[model samples]
Target: MSYARIGKGRNLPEQLEDDLRKAIVSGELAEGQALPTEPDLAQRYGVSRSVVRDAVRLLIAKGLVEIRRGKGTFVRAARGEAFAEALLLALARNGGTALDIEEFYGLLLPGIAALSAERASSGDRDRMLLRAEAYLEAFGREALDPSSDGPGLLRALFEAFMNEILKACDNKLVELVGGLLVRMRSFRDLAPEEGAREGGVAAIIELEERAIMGLARAVAGGKASEARAFAVRLCELRPSLRARLASTPAGDMPKLSFDMLAPIVQDS
Candidate 1:
């Protein structure tokens, strides 16, 4: 693994944590492998053992490393999954509304689309198309054909599709936040106004699916600006989404299921 001299912007511990995190994120530190001993790290980094300990503690909190009582500290799961789990716990304890979360997406998703446009590999784009196709098929079957699947399943499909787009974006930090949003399933229960339901739930699903597919294509084609625009226009089509955001009190957001926040093991 390549190493760089610690930068001056942050304090020693923060700098230490950032360097360590980069290594972990870059796959220099393999998952479940023990980290270097504190004494060894201190010597390598030219810092005191206390600073190494503090840095390791920070890594522990960030979910990049885990400590066993008898065994040494080891790399945890994927950094992004760890970050998502930590954010989920924070939301559960601090409390926030679904709309508040939507507003966050307004800020988050466009950038994700733009990034995906710029960074997505051919394989990444293919995965997105596959997910979009899956969403369309599922929704079409439920709407056009008789099925036992509930609206909740369609909601899951929507979240899964969005999650795929996020993964395609290839920004780990953004992916972490996107994972939290996908699992924030409470808003799935937020119903539209009576008039909005006139076209029926199938209509909503169809419209959303079309827009999502278009957005995916835009990203796949490497049209960064177009991808961003498609995302904004999608929200315009679903005023209720923005309405739900407006109506939700930030602190009153529902607590998501802890089971949903479990860390996923990421293969480096």
Candidate 2:
């Protein structure tokens, strides 16, 4: 397993956690395997026991491993699943503005798209294409409201993307980001006028089609970098859309607040 390259003057705990996490995700440390004791890990990593403890705590908080009482820390069998839920909850509670979410999507969506392109089965590609067509259809008629189907279409896209890596990444951090992206769509608001201007919901479908097709081709061709780049371009669209919406009249805007979103994930 390749440890995260640590630059000079990097924080100890952060570096240690990065290395340990990479090791776990790379299968250097198998699931259900006991990690070395704090003292041993500290000595092996050339850090103080305190630093090792902090790193362990960081991993625990991410739901990566469990420190059993009187036993060593054990890799979680369902770490990725647990992390996804936790991340979604966190984003629902704390994710601000369309811009903030857009930035995250910029970082994640393209990579997922690329991965889907490279690794998606025929069934997966078909599913994405079908969803893209539905999304396009949803925006077609004048009577068809963009606000009504916009969120749902976006949700579908997110779900399709989620299926690509929900099992493969096996890293809590990656899963958390995926869950956050999925949950963030709930906060999006599409005013009628804005939707019409951007090709009346059809544009979104078109965009998805392009993204999915690009991803499919990239993945099928084993072009991981190309797939990732396509996703990054798609991610840029959110901020662009947000900017356009922000410039329009205020009366069309929906009344939403962070307080209103808190309860959705309070229990989780």
Best by TM-score: 1
**Which residue pairs clash in candidate 1?**
96-253, 97-253
**Global CA lDDT of candidate 1, please?**
0.67
Per-residue C-alpha lDDT of model 2 across residues 1-268, encoded as one tens digit per residue: 3433334598898888888888788888888998888887777777788988999999888777898888889988753556555654564466445445545666776666555555666665556555545533443432145445555564465455454443233445556666655555443343445334433244444444565456545655557788676655545443345664334332233333212211111110
User: Global lDDT of each model?
Assistant: 0.67, 0.56
Give the distance in Å from residue 30's predicted Cα in candidate 1 to where it truly belongs. Answer: 3.0
Question: For model 2, what is the alpha-carbon lDDT of residue 169?
Answer: 36
True lDDT of residue 61, candidate 2: 84
Candidate 1 lands at a TM-score of 0.59
Candidate 1, 62-140: lDDT as tens digits: 7789999889999987746666666666765766555666667767778888888898889888888888787677666
TM-score between model 2 and native: 0.45
User: Residue 183: error of model 1 in Å?
Assistant: 3.3
